[model samples]
Structure formats: structure tokens, C-alpha cells
Target: MGYVSQAESSFPAQVGKDFEEFIALSSVHCDGWGISTNDRQHAHAVLEKKVEAAAESATFQKVIADNAADGALLHLRWATKGLSISENNTHPFVYGDYSFIHNGSIFPPDSFSDFIDEKFKKLIVGDTDSERYFYLMMTQIEKLGLAEGIKTTLAIIKEHGKTTSLNFMLMNKESFVVGSEHNSEKKPDWAPADYYVIKYKKDADGVLFASSGWNQPGWHTLENHHAAIVNRSTFEIDVINL
Candidate 1:
């Protein structure tokens, strides 16, 4: 999912500009890169092994810390579904201005294929249920607000979860949402075991919400079944119930 303001530049421009600055300032090393911008021109391709190697090198860390973004979503994928190693199979699936990524799977894709419209089912260019689920949520969100759309989307996934699990992340430039559901038949350990932590930093302008703790302190976790909305201008973090 990706979006771009008319006044702002293209998705790739924002990523390269912001990322280069981030590297310069933070000195962090990134293994892989994935981004979803405002226009849905999702780019999840792997950086060349050499690029990843360079990013992980000590010299690269100094480059990331300097950059800042009004809105950004980053993903480090450890593929759990889909076998294709190409960029299309990677994270940060983009559509319009929305970008999406998931950490879990929806099994027996054939069984739930009908729940998604034929048009969207056709838009599915990848084999992973993660991308399908992202499109499903996007279709719903276009019809409903983010929170309500997520709720309705979860209902559909729950209906299909008689055989699978849904643990995923959805983000636009302004808000970030995540949800998890498991099958009763499967043991807890067998279900998705990933956990997420969200932290907030209040600056004079507004707040910043990060996935993990930053060096400065004051980070928080987004509870299960909850969504966090960060106002782009105010930087206020609003927690919405799923």
C-alpha cells in the first residue's frame, strides 16, 4: 500500500531521499529493504546480496540515523509463505498510496479465493496469501474507514480461518494497523509467534511512532487488536480499537 501527496515527490524519490538521509544520520545497517508508499506502487524487491552485505556492514550504520520522514513503513522479511525469490514476492506490497506487509499466512488459498472479488482476485500477481489479504483489506478500506474496514476484513478472515491464521500489518502514510487471529485446533506455539512493540516520541512538532525502542527512550507497545493513528502534522498517536 502506498500514497503520495501531489505536492510531494514520487515514492521512489521519497524512499531514496529519506533512506539515504536516515543512513547518514543513524548509522544503522539494514539487511533488506521494503517500502509501501502513498500510491500503491509497492516495491518489495530484495536489495542485491552485495547491497544487503553493504547495508549490514559497519560503515552503513552511520548513514541511516540522520534521515527523517513525514511518513514511512519499513519491513525486514523472513519469508514464511510463497517460494518466489523475486521482488514481486517480497514485502511492502503497494497499491495506490497504500502499502502492506504481513508476518503470517492464510492457508488453503483456494478455499477463501471466492471471498475476494473476481477483479481483486485477478489483481493478485503473487502466490502468497499475504498479498491477497492485503488486496482484500484494501478493497474493504476503500469502502469503509480504516478501522471499520479492518474489522470487516477480520470477519472475513475469521470465517476462513477454519483452516488458517491471519496475522498481518496494514499502513497508509497516516496510520498503521495490525491484527492477529489463530485457529483453536492448532497449538499456541504452532500459531504465529511474532510480537510487535510501538514506541512514541514527542517532539515540539508532534509524535513519532516506531516499531521498537529507539535509543532515546519512551517507547510503547500497540496492544493486540488495536490500531495506531499518527497524525502527520501533530504527530499525535491515537489508539483505535479493532
Candidate 2:
């Protein structure tokens, strides 16, 4: 549902072929589109709160071209869990300084509410499992460091709850983290194989991370249940067990 690029260099003026193909595959995902970028302002983001498909939105192209950020997170929403269609539900949800998005569903959607801190509960403005996943990670990050926070949160989701797919991207001004984890063997008929596949590559300018639907050349598929962590300044990357 989203794509992430490392912050070492400027992003393309327009969204690329991979994005176009992704949208063409399903225009229904066009509930709304949001982008999180590390432009002059750290972790700044923009949202197009329209009901039209993003690939067909002139505003989407103009904003993307106007703000060629060092790092960017692009998301297209496909409503699930009976969530409503609105900008507030769109992804790249900002809390404190972090921007987060997800490509999977968490079973028992509201279960994470109890795990969320009372203070952070007020920060939850959306009704999607992805947003809950983001806040859950935030709660852990508030207690532990970034990596430990995500690691601990994921562990709980896998053990205590049922995650059809835990694939996600979480970014701040300094760096970003992404994961490719899911129940590949137990998918329903409606869930496509592309839903579980994620690919990553260190491009000439920076790095690229995305779900398989994008179809960018030279991207290597990430192993299931593994996460990639990349630093913004140094561009150092590590693939760790999730």
C-alpha cells in the first residue's frame, strides 16, 4: 500500500512506472493518497483528500514534482474493516515526528487499543488496523528505542493476535524501517500473492522499499518476517530478523 525511498538524494520529479503499474492494477485502491517526505522540513507530509484514484489525480503529480524530497513515503488507501473513506483515514499518519503506513490487516482490529497508552490514544485519528499498528509501535518506541520498539510490538502481534500480514513501513526524519512478515500459507481466496511479497534495492541515488505490486526492476524480494533498517545520513542498511 506504500513505498519508501532513502533520504541520501532527491526523489524523481514525478512518480515512476512502478507506481503507475501499481495503480493500474487496481484503481479501487484510490480512496486517498498521502506522502511523507523529509524535505526542508523534517518528516513533513502532504495528503490529497479526494475520492478519485491517485494515478488519475493531477494534484498528486503536481505535489510530487514540486516537492522532490530526500526521502519519501507514498501511500494509496484501499478501505478495509468497514473503515470510512476520508483523508483522516489515509496513511502516512503523523504522530509526534513519525510517519507510518501498512500493507496488511491485523485480526481483531480493535485489540491493540488496550495495549495503547492513554496519552497516545488521543493521537489515534483513524480507524484502520494499520493506524493501530503504528500507535502500538509508538508506544513501544516511547518505552524502548526504535528497533526494540518495533521488534517488541511485532512479537506481541504475532503471539497474542492474528496478523494476516504485518508488512509495514515506519519513518522519521532521521531514518526508516520496513518489514515483510505474513501468514503466507493461510491466505484467503481474495488475498493475492503480491500482498505478501516485498522487495528492496539500493539504487544509484538511495534505496527503495516497496510491496511486490510495484514491479520495479532490479528489486530483490525480502525474506518473510525480516525487516530492513536504513540510516538517513550514512545510508547504512541492515536486514534483521523480525
Residue 136 Cα positional deviation in candidate 2, in Å, after optimal superposition = 1.0
Worst 10 residues of 1 by lDDT: 42-51
Per-residue CA lDDT of model 2 for 1-242, tens digit only, reads 33344433323422465556865644757777777764436535543345557788888777656755666677777777578877777877877557788876777777667788788788878777788888888999889988888899998777767778888888776777888888786655776676678887775456777776556687788889888888866767788998
Q: Summarize candidate 1's per-residue lDDT along 65-151 as a digit string, tens digits.
A: 432333445555444444554456666676655667664455655445666766677778767667777877877887887878877
| Model 2: lDDT of residue 96 | 52
Measured by lDDT, the strongest candidate is: 2
Q: Which stretches of candidate 2 lie over 4 Å from their true place?
A: 1-17, 40-49, 186-192
